[model samples]
Target chain A: METILKVKNLKKYFGRVKAIDGVSFEVEKGEILGFLGPNGAGKTTTIRCLLDFIRPSNGEIEIFGYSSRNPDFYKSRSKIGYLIAGSNLVEQWTGYDHLSYQEALHGESKIKNELIKKFSFDPKPKVKNLSTGNRQKLGLIMTLMSEPEFLVMDEPTASLDPILQEEFYKIIRKLSSEGVTVFMSSHNLAEVEKVCSKVAMIKSGKLITVQKISALEGKKIHSVKITFSEKVSKDLLVDKNTEIQEEIPNGFELSVKGEMDAFIKKIAKLKIESISIMQANLEEIFLEFYKK
Target chain B: MIAIIKRALRDRFIPFISYSIGGIVLVWMYIALLPSVQQSQVQLQDVMKAMPEGLMKALGVSGVNLASLEALLAMKQYNMIWPLLMIFFIVSFAGGMIAGEVENRTIEIVLSSAKSRAKIFFSKYLSGIIYLILFVVATTLCAIPMAKLYGYEYAAPNYYTLMYLSLCFGLAVYGLSILFSSLFSSRGKVYGISGILFVAMYVLFILVSLKDSLKNLQYISFFYYYNINDALIHNKIDGLSVFVFLSIGLIASLLALIIFLDRDFAV
Candidate 1:
């Protein structure tokens, strides 16, 4: 278990506004760590600090046991790839020109053509002529082509169509399987949950919790819907973690916080026609953290 | 750094060629017309005699003979047309260099690379200097062939002094443009602010030249050191002038490097 990146008490402030207030996290090798937060939740800020695109107001980031601010970090940089949201490419040149240029910078590419074929974007067309999604594809190729061991992506799949998004996921899956580490930020909870080994939920520039995807199972509440054959008192379920959310003529929706086995057995004793138990998604879990 | 220079060159190369063509036209028009203008020199001098003394001095034509090909070409080509072309070239180039990248959100990608901000800034600045030399050399080369074809009358003008002045003057304006570019994030604002500053400086230089009491203002105006006709016609390379312009360029670029390196890139 190699700890490739370590960020400690990171704080970045714009004037008086603390963009990221004392965020601390670590990413191990070959793991997909999802940085989950809403729009201004310091996700991009944290990534920018990690990449040294901007200096942190206070704190430090270690990349591969070296300070991220090290003058020789370039040696480590060759092992890292990043895809920026709304990438800026030379519009006058074709996508291949950008690919060749970046390849030259990072040395010869091992996966350039493979990623191109996988993403399916025209490399011959001028960048100005490429669609937003295609430009995103070109950006993806530019970053992934070097076959870097680590990837820091900021909403890499936002502009792509659903099919392309799936393609991006497949590529990430393949990359992760090959033992490449990834640190990505996304408000796309389902996609993050589907692929991320672990998630760090952040709100208002503070880390709420870092949980394994499975650990979220009982750590947060799940919403449950039950329809009874007849009107019944809310007391039919005796579990304290379960509370009726919306009452219906014949059914009620309950928010269940923890384990539901006790609540389910109690509800089963009462004649229930049908029951559907729904688990809270990552976004809901995040909202709960915000409330707390 | 190499990648960035390639991209910057890709962006600036076409416009540079077009400007060179425009420069060629100006150089050819002035030099190719020199022989004929020399023939009408007496009449032209006569026509110039009636002009008011104040107007002549303001136009920088006082004590300058329109009869010599050197004087006429120096006034028309070196002082006015060539500098104008160089000003636009350097201003737009410097304006777009880093500021353009920042505005387009492209600097983020470039910054993500292993290169330092200083590396990026210096590489692009060096390319601009190369372009400046090429542009100035091209114009001078265009003039030499045409002057030979047209049989330039006066003693072959000092090519070295002309080139030196052009480089110095180019550096001066280029420095201001890059400074403005580094100061502003928006590409258009870079151009707009530098353009406004250039015009203001040019105007101030004119007013300072016209008013004996306001001559001290020349210290701030780049156009003050950009006396190309004085440098060419007199064969006088002012060391102070060269130092001032080059220093302006180097100092401005230094400030740009400092600010660019230290500033947080919002992109």
Candidate 2:
């Protein structure tokens, strides 16, 4: 697959404070890459650098094969769509005014009406009068109206209701299927996991890891809790990858990584009353990364 | 670019029309009183002679013959009243040009488009120039028709010179305010800095005009370069003054664009 966005060794500093430290990642064509981080973890800073709104103190960003530092990089913006986290719309302007301005810049948006209907946004009221959720809906419609090749959003669904968030995910999925590259930052791990194919985790201005969602879910980390009728030696299930979370008189809560076959066989030799195995979800993996 | 300009002009439409009509009516009302003032020229001259030279200069009525309609209009309209009005409008309008957008976070929307920063700056700057021209033209050009309505012999060339000087002055004020606008994100900061700067310059101009020993420092004030008396009464357009105004305007505007292009919109 072709890479649509590339960030390498990116560092941004405000005075002596490093906002983004040696962060690097890539998004391939037609891929939905979710940028996951806590508040002030350099997600917005990285996005700003990617959009060339702010210059990086070190390293570089390349979008569509053009260096972001290039003076002509603005030419590539025509194919990019952006949605700021909050209501960045003009307070005095109606939704129609914003749409008309965008249409004037690019051609008329063919899917403008469809996105508005899907979001159930009313474009007649001035933005100042719109509620926060309605304002987010308008911003979402604006980002998707032009049908850009690459979409960069900052906390795109931070204010959307659950149903609207689900609808937004469907639109993102549909857009990705049509070969649109999406890179969005969100603290909502569930939202990211629902739509994004890959996730890049960032913490304290550093990238923890970037991996496929499926790969993260298939990490072979499982929580096993076994209640045996009789007391068993803790050494019986001894394995390098297995961690005993809790010790009881007749039970053990084990967190096993990788294969469970040997542990299952070992436990089978002993009498077991009840056994429960729960697979690790993305949230658990995210928490583990944060803990580290 | 045109759309951006249109949006800017549309946003400022109410203020533009209000100020234009206010300026025209103000000029016309001052002209309406001209005939009576001219009729009492001797009495006014006596009163001017009784006033101290320093006080007269401070009032912008000392250096010129008060008998002339142009001199009376310059003293009454352009001297303190009209400039105060123009400064208020320029500071409020140009202060919001760039800083207001950034403060409201609407600049991100504009920057998200394909246009370069230069294009956006010029588009908004161009809208301001349009308003400035309209204000200056409406206020200055009406003097000719207004004097004609009062049956006073007024020179058209004098008002034309006034228009030229006024445009340059407006541009200078606009440049100063916009430069501050580019540097600060808050419109209130822009207003405060530009307001204090203008007040200082006006005070300096008044001091130099009042005291001959302070004459050397007169050149520091834009008010000195304005030379409204020469433009109106003498029908003289000083090339140096024009150059200074245009230079300040161009340099400030250029610096504004440069700073705006390099500025990082934090969050």
Candidate 3:
């Protein structure tokens, strides 16, 4: 597989604050890599470094075989698109003016009209008068209109409503299908789980893990609740990776990690009234990481 | 490159027109009073002779005949008021080009394109130079046609000299503005630093005029080189003055471009 983006041991320091400390990651062609982190976890810093907006104090970033510091990196930039949270659009300019300006810069965008229609954005209003959601929509359109081969987005859907977010996800999925590589940082776990093929989680300026979505789900934690017509001891279903969270009047709320085969087998023998099992979402998995 | 320049000028279109119109009106108002001032030249000369020589020198009107239209315009218009307005226009124009973009965070969007930073930086600087050209032409050169309208046969060559001096002075200010804009992220900082520096230069020019000991220090001030009285009255263009202003402008603008190309945009 072609390595579309490669960042090795990237470090950015603002005085004593290490915004990103020795972080390394790669995204292949057509891969949608979700960068997940809490606020101040250096997600935006990494994105800025990748796009040459801010220089990393150490290490290197290469996109399409051009080091970020190389003059030729600008050639690669023509094929890349970026969006930041709460984009700074010119307040006095109408959406059309921005589109015209972008067109002037990157040439005519083939999907400009389609994206505008899909996002339901009016192109006549000045940026200052638009709602936050509408502004985000304009930003999204600006980033995607060029149909770039690579996208580096920082919380691209941050201000979108759920419906618009879903639409954005669909558009991203379509782009990915057409072999567009994407690296997006987002705190929305559901959005990542819905659209990303793999996830890179960072905490306190350090990347803790990068794994496939399936691998993440394989380690999913399950919350199980069982009710019994007759009282049963909590020790009955207790096993490795399974802990009793709380004991209720009739049963116990249990936390089960990893495979639940043994716990299910034990529950099948004695559940008299009702049993409920819930799979943990990515948020839960990340919360555990945060706790650690 | 053209797009960047176009957008910059478009963003500042309103201010550009306002300053040009304001300058025209101010010059026209001074011209309207020229006839009346000429009628009272004898009385004005008496008052000028009675005033302290240092004060008159500080005002750029020392030992000059008030009867000449050149002297009247130079003393009344070019001495302080026009230059102050010109500096204000250039500061705001050059300041907003880079530092303002960073402060408002629009630089991210501007840099989002594939254009090189050098292209963007020079485009903005060139646009400012372009504005400075138009500004000097409108404010200073327009005096000829304006004087013609008032039936005053002003010397065309002197006004042309004034235009050259004004353009060079403006380039120096624009250079300073761009330099400050490159170093600072905030537009207000650029305005403050550049403002204070030019104000200090003006004060230095005044102090040098008032005190002989400080006269040796006058060469350091840009206002010292902007000899409007000499340009208008003698119809002379000082080679040293032009060289100083142009060299500062070239060196400062080149420094600004170098700094902009190297410095990180943390914003």
Best by DockQ: 3
DockQ of each: 0.51, 0.63, 0.64
lDDT of 3 by residue, B126-239 (tens): 899899999999898888988888888789999989999999999989988999999989999999999999999999988888889888899999988999889998899899
Q: Sorted by TM-score, highest first, which candidate order results?
A: 2, 3, 1
List native contact recovery per candidate, as a fraction of 1: 0.52, 0.66, 0.70
Off by over 4 Å in 2: A226-275, B39-43
lDDT of 1 by residue, B64-92 (tens): 98776667767677766676788888888
Per-prediction interface RMSD in Å? 2.0, 1.3, 1.3
Categorize the docking of model 3: medium
**Full ranking by lDDT:** 3, 2, 1
Tens digit per residue, CA lDDT, model 3, A1-292: 9999998999999999999999998899999999999999999899888777788899989999989767767677798988744558888889999889888988898889988889889999899999999889988888888879999898988889999988989989999999999999999898899999999999888898888888888776998888899778877777778888898779889888877887777777884687789998778777767766
Please report, in order, the local distance difference test score of every candidate based on alpha carbons: 0.80, 0.87, 0.88
Question: How good is the docking of model 1, by CAPRI class?
Answer: medium
State which candidate, 2 or 3, has the greater DockQ. Answer: 3
Q: How do the residues A101-177 of candidate 2 rate in per-residue lDDT, one tens digit apiece?
A: 87887679999999888888899999899999989998888888899999999999888999998888888999999
Instruction: Judge candidate 1 at residue B64 and give its lDDT.
Output: 91
In Å, residue A85's CA in model 3 sits off its true spot by: 4.4
lDDT of 2: 0.87
lDDT by residue for model 2 over B1-267, one digit each (tens)? 898899889989988888888888988887888778878888988888998797677666886777677898789888777788888898889877788878887888888888887898899899999999999999888899878877888878999999999999999899988999888888999999998998999999888877899999889898888877888988998999999999999999899889888888653
